[model samples]
Target: MPNSTLHPLASLPNLGPRTAWFLDEIGVATEADLRRLGAVDAYRRLKFQFGRQISLNALYALAGAIENRDWRSFNEEEKAQLRAKVEG
Candidate 1:
């Protein structure tokens, strides 16, 4: 029921129409919804349903959007640490 035009999740970098649709199908329809679910659960669910690895690119994008940080500005080490925290 959420429209991409008005959804903040749609504004995330690298999240195309297909990815947005996939998120919506999995009950993530808004930025707040995504934030509520958080990165770990979202990544896990995406992996479970899609059978594809959740890259740090996607995880950082989602986390940055949720935390209001600049995704691209995060250092590789910081990103790796965050990913490690989430994965474990």
Candidate 2:
């Protein structure tokens, strides 16, 4: 079992400790904040803070987290849209 006291962000898929830290640094400290920001916006914010050092996988992971699925769950179309939004 996991620690019940873990931050809500830790409960989401693909958001391992380091990725969670990035989100935390950006003030997305909870699942609700993640949702409110959405994957693209959250990726944008993280990118803005961390520069190009952030992984594209993290963006897909955020999309997966919002949908309560694995990052691999995203289809090509969804991934493309997300890429466009972040890269735009």
Error of 1 at 49 (Å): 1.1
- For model 1, residues 1-88, the per-residue Cα lDDT tens digits are 3456645566776465556766777789877778789876776777677765456577777777677777788898988887797768
For residues 1-88, could you state the per-residue lDDT of candidate 2 as single tens digits?
2333466687798887677778888889889999998999999889899987798888999999999899998899988988998888
For model 1, the run of ten residues with the poorest summed lDDT: 1-10
User: Cα-based RMSD of the predictions, in order?
Assistant: 3.1, 3.7
Compare the candidates by lDDT and give the number of the best one. 2
TM-score of each: 0.73, 0.85
Which candidate has the highest TM-score of all? Answer: 2
Candidate 2 local accuracy as lDDT? 0.86
Model 2 ranges with Cα > 4 A deviation: 1-5
